[model samples]
Target: MTDLLFQAFIAAGGTAGFCIIFRVPLREIPICAIIGAAGWILYNVVLLTGDDNKVFATFLAAALVGLLSEIAARIFKEPTTLFTVPGVLSLVPGFHIFKAMEAVMDNNMDSSESWVTITFKLAAAIALGLLAIGAIFNAAHAIFNKTKHVTTDMMGTLKNMTTPPGKK
Candidate 1:
């Protein structure tokens, strides 16, 4: 739909702006923008299922962003935060913060409390999602490097065994 495209465009632009403000590499700006757009789109799609669980939607979106950021970090040899920090900007509950402030200004304690609770939940979901992906990738990387070292050591031992004793 046109609306979805428009939202994606907005998210990308916001992400690009964030990169610009933070002085991210020029070459990385577009990649960060795409990551942000993808995350926002995914959040929207998940919400469309009518589950009404914005926290879960945010968690999934942040996880997707984390996954993409890790892949991009490997391919580009840049820090994952360079991609992930900007990529998650779109999912931040800015509207909820505004609503909470407005409720406070109007002396509506109940509404303000509800908005604050939801905002905190959404923020936690994002953090947990990113943490989950980072742990998985780090564990995998460690396992892979361990295996590579073992294989290299085995190759060296095999070479030593095949040589004649007088060769030294």
Candidate 2:
């Protein structure tokens, strides 16, 4: 849809602007922009597909961002945060914060409290999503390195056994 594409374009532009402000290298800006756009698109798609749970949608989008950021980091040899921080900027619940403040200004404590609660839930979802992906990646990396080291050590031992005492 045109609206979705427009929103994605806005998301990408916002991400690129943030990256520029934070001094992210120009060469990496496009990648960050694309990641941010993809996350926003996923969030919108989740919302459009029957289940309108904002929190769940946000969590899913955050997870996608984390996964993509991790992959981009590995492929581009950059820090994961470089891709993640800007990518997540668009997903932040800024509107909820604004609404909470507006409610407080109107002496509507209950409304303000609800909005605050919603904001916290959304924030927590984002954190948990990123944390889950980071943990998974770290565990996999550790296992892979361990396997590689063991294999390398076995190869060395085998070489020593066949080298006839290094031909000394």
Candidate 3:
């Protein structure tokens, strides 16, 4: 448990640093940090479970973080893309991508295959992450639009009551 917590802290810190380095909005930094921490925790859990479905786990983690990020964006009235980018940075599979490219450059077929597998896993993770973000943003937008319409109607009614009808 302690290890997990430490890892989470590290991931969050790293994410926050990245955001700061890139001059991301201060308001969005914490959200990105929290999401990063959660993603790392999920990654560690999946790794420890010794399950064969590692790819699935990675995908689920990414999706969850992405959804959370979208929700945060809605709450803060900022662009979800900004938050999601930093939030999901921790799960970008940088090592896998690098290894795959390296293998190809070296002409090592077996290594290349292994690296390709990693690439596929990373791709699935990214896809799942995107799906979650899209779903959450769509739902949030629908709800927000409905609420806005209701509020606008109510305000119009109040204005009508206060104003004398047919005033020039």
Q: Top model by TM-score, which number? A: 2
TM-score rank order? 2, 1, 3
Question: Candidates' lDDT values, in order?
Answer: 0.91, 0.91, 0.80
Local accuracy of candidate 3 as per-residue lDDT tens digits, 49-110: 88776677778778878877777876888887787777778877788888999999999999
lDDT of 1 by residue, 23-134 (tens): 9999999999999999999999898888888999999999999999999999999999999999998999999989989998999999999998998999999999899999
The better-scoring model by TM-score among 2 and 3 is: 2
Candidates 1 and 2 compared: the better one by TM-score is 2
Write down the worst ten-residue block by lDDT for model 2: 158-167
lDDT ranking from best candidate downward: 1, 2, 3
Off by over 4 Å in 3: 143-168
Regions of model 1 farther than 4 Å from truth:
147-168
**Candidate 2 local lDDT, 1-168, one digit each (tens):** 999999999999999999999999999999999999999999999999996799998999999999999999999999999999999989999999899889989999899999989999999989988898999999998787663333236446542232245454
TM-score for each predicted model, relative to the true structure: 0.85, 0.85, 0.76
